[model samples]
Target: MIRVLAFDVFGTVVDWRSSIIGELEQFGKSQGLQRDWGAFADSWRGGYVPAMNQVRRGELPWTRLDDLHRRILDELLREAGIQADEDDVDHLNRAWHRLAPWPDAVAGLHRLKERFTITTLSNGNVSLLTEMAKRAGLPWDCVLSAEIFGHYKPDPEAYLGCADIMDVAPDELMLVAAHPSDLRAARDAGLRTAYVDRPLEWGQPGRYRVPFEADEFDSIATDLLDLADKL
Candidate 1:
């Protein structure tokens, strides 16, 4: 029986695109800036995994997600032609720390917490997750991250590490995620899995291939609320 349900935050627990673009829109309007923030948002996001990958591979010094985001934020600010001062840009860059949880995320998590020990297992740094929990009222029993293990997802250590640190057998820990590759890694590491469909994660609704299925996981659901019901 599963006692814990660890979440993969970005697209799974919160909607990064809408959160980022919405903040960018507000900031842009406040500053009277003229630029396409969506492309900037996309480009900024494009830098994230690679940044962590470099640190994980030892190609670069160890850096947290906030630092990696700040690095990319500076790079993209010039690209987006946002002429804010350093302090303004720095404040804006930390917006990820304040992203809004998905419409169903907070309530769904609250419901799940009644039955399961819920935690976050994401590439996001601990400080990022903590600040987000404060901002969005996430009810996590504990927060786990790549920062804790000094490794990112798809690494067996990061997957198995979660199970080990939590003192649970792989079968007792279920990874609830929207990303296929992350779930695949967790499965290969012997953990149970649930694929929560988050087709709107990329933002802008559209038809696309279902990249994973029930065969890839122990269970699948349309959303966290549905996942909670199935479990």
Candidate 2:
């Protein structure tokens, strides 16, 4: 039986692209600047993996997602020739903490939590995830993050560390994620895997694709609510 349901936060539970774009739109309107914030959000997210890889490869020190987001925000602003003061930049960088959950996230999680221990197993920093949970009203029993493991997702440590933290065997834990690579990693670590189809995770129709193979995940559902139903 699955004793714990560990979720991937950003795209899996919350709609980061839409949330980030909403914040960017508000900030742009406040500053009388107009740009394709969707593209801007995409560009900012494009830096995420490479930044984490830098730390993973030992080229850079272990940095929290908050710092990485800020660093990427600064670089993006420079590259786009967007002018803003330090205060503006800092405030804008914090938009990650204010992301909104997907329509089914809270309700589905509540349903799943009735039967299993539900927590976060995300690459986000603890403080960032905590703030986001509060802002988004996410009802996570515990918020676990890469900060605790010193490794990002797809890293064996991050996956196994979550099971360790919950004091459960890897098989007793089920990782529910939108990304197949994340699910594959958890599966490789001996955890059950459930794929939640997040069709618009990248803010475009064609950006996300569910794996065709039925064996790719232990369970696959159209959304978290559907996953809850399947469970």
Candidate 3:
């Protein structure tokens, strides 16, 4: 029996792409510059995996997602010839903390929380996820992250560590994520998996969609509300 529901926050619970693009647009306006904020947003997000992989591969020591994001942002700014003060860049880097939840996320989570203990199981650091939950009113019973385990998602340690911390068996902890890869990893770690559809996660339908078998995940839902019903 699943006693805990661990959510992947970025594209699953919140619309990261749109939120970052909006922040980028505002930043551009403040700097009196014009560029493809959409593409810039994409590039910034695009750097996430590579940056994480650097730590995963031991190329870099365990780094917080916030710092990884800043590294990516600084590189992107240099590539685009954009210059700003440290304070300005720091504020902009916090755009991730201010991401808006999807329409169904808050409500769906509340419903889910009534049945199962809900917490974050994200690659974001504790501070990042905590601030995000506070700002977006995510209502997590607790915030958990890869930082605590020193292993990012797709790693067995992260999944198992979450279960351990929650004092539940791996199978009793379900991972709810929009990404099949993330769910697959959790499944491999002996956890139940739910795949939530977020087709517009990349700002366009099917832009970054991945194929999955029909019976691969334990449950599949159109959104968090549907997930509540199915669960």
* Count of backbone clashes, every candidate in sequence: 0, 0, 0
- Over 4 Å off, model 3: none
Each prediction's whole-model lDDT (CA): 0.86, 0.91, 0.96
Reference-based TM-score of each model: 0.94, 0.97, 0.99
Candidate with more favorable, higher lDDT: 1 or 2: 2
TM-score-superior candidate, 2 or 3: 3
Question: Model 3, residue 55: what's the lDDT?
Answer: 96
Error of 1 at 86 (Å): 2.2
Among these predicted structures, which one has the highest lDDT?
3
Q: Give one digit per residue, the lDDT tens place, for model 1 in 128-185.
A: 9999999899999999998899888878888788888888988899999988888988
Clashing pairs in 1: none
Candidate 1: 10-residue stretch with minimal lDDT = 205-214
**Ranking of models by TM-score:** 3, 2, 1
- In angstroms, how far off is 151's CA in candidate 2? 0.7
lDDT-sorted candidate list, best first? 3, 2, 1
